[model samples]
Target: MSATGHDYAITRTLDAPVEKVWAAWTDTESYGRWASAEEVVLDVRPGGAWSSVMVIPGGARIPLTGSYTEVVPNERLVMGMNVPGRDEPVLMALDLTPDGDRTKITLSQTFDRAEDRDQSEQGSNMLLDGLTRFLAAA
Candidate 1:
């Protein structure tokens, strides 16, 4: 937790293979299918860029942008993202573990400030829930 006061970690299991899950995260089209509420665009290689706009249930939209910091096929991904009005970027790490016929995905995000961390934890958990649902349907 940086100056602002928040810290969080979220994990979810998907009934899909690591490869399929990786594809959903790295491919723009598949990412949009699960991760995007309004829109999503991704350039998945290291140093590549990504962006998305999430529409809240009540009609507000929040935009997010980031660059890929690391990518390891179907195992891991690390990215740096910045929220609107925030001066510092947050670091996010995604770990995918193969579990027999399923995949366990863990997402960890660290913010420079505690306030942002708390806010992001809630939002990211919601997004992960959506991803779980989407993967189930897919």
Candidate 2:
């Protein structure tokens, strides 16, 4: 559970090293391999920008853009995620911790309304699942 003022939070433990999991989130090519996105551009530094085009199952493409507010290598990442046609960007925080030979990842997304967070829950979990599988195969 996260007390980061987020509307939604999900946690997953990956059977991969912390450094490997960290790279999966921060590196462009690694992220593209695991993320549910058609294309990804990640500049993983504070104030750096990142963007991705999420390909929905039914061929819908949603463009997402964000800027990193905080980036602590292999530990935490905070970003402002821009929603399509929305002026205010949602805040997202990702925290990583080492657990033996594995990594524990907690992802939190803050939205204005509970409905919005509910709507995003499934996709967010799917994203983490995808990461888990990717890491397992790596």
Candidate 3:
């Protein structure tokens, strides 16, 4: 759980090693492959930029922009996403722990509104599913 009020928190263990999971989160191509987003542009260092243009199944498009607020190599990441009409940025933190050969990932997201937080939780699940599939195929 985050220090702030985190509306969504997910803990998942991936079969892959910490190195692979960390690469997936930090590398643009790997991230794009499993992020359920298109045209992803990632600059992974602290204070760097990240953005993704999402394309829905029905042809709807949503663009997301954000920056990496903090980076701790393979262990953790802190970031915030920018929403057009929102006053405050949606914050997210990801922590990775190596468990044997697998990696345990905990994700926390804080949203200003409950509704938005609920919606984002579903998307977060989908993103984790995508990452699972991506690892399976590897």
Off by over 4 Å in 1: 1-6, 84-88
TM-score, cand. 1: 0.86
Candidate 3 whole-model C-alpha lDDT, 0 to 1 = 0.86
Candidates sorted by TM-score, best first: 3, 2, 1
Worst 10 residues of 3 by lDDT: 1-10
Per candidate, the number of residue pairs that clash is 4, 0, 0
Q: Model 3, range 1-138, lDDT digits (tens) per residue?
A: 356554788999999999999899888888888876788888889889999887656888889999998899889999888888877667789999999999999988876567878888888788889999999898
Q: Against the true structure, candidate 1 has what lDDT?
A: 0.82
TM-score of each candidate structure, all chains considered together: 0.86, 0.90, 0.91
**Residue 88 miss distance in model 3 (angstroms):** 3.1
Model 2 stretches astray by more than 4 angstroms: 1-6
Which residue pairs does candidate 1 place in steric collision?
Answer: 4-114, 4-115, 5-114, 6-114
lDDT of 1 by residue, 12-107 (tens): 888999998888888877777676555787888898988988778788888879899999999999988875676866778989999988999998
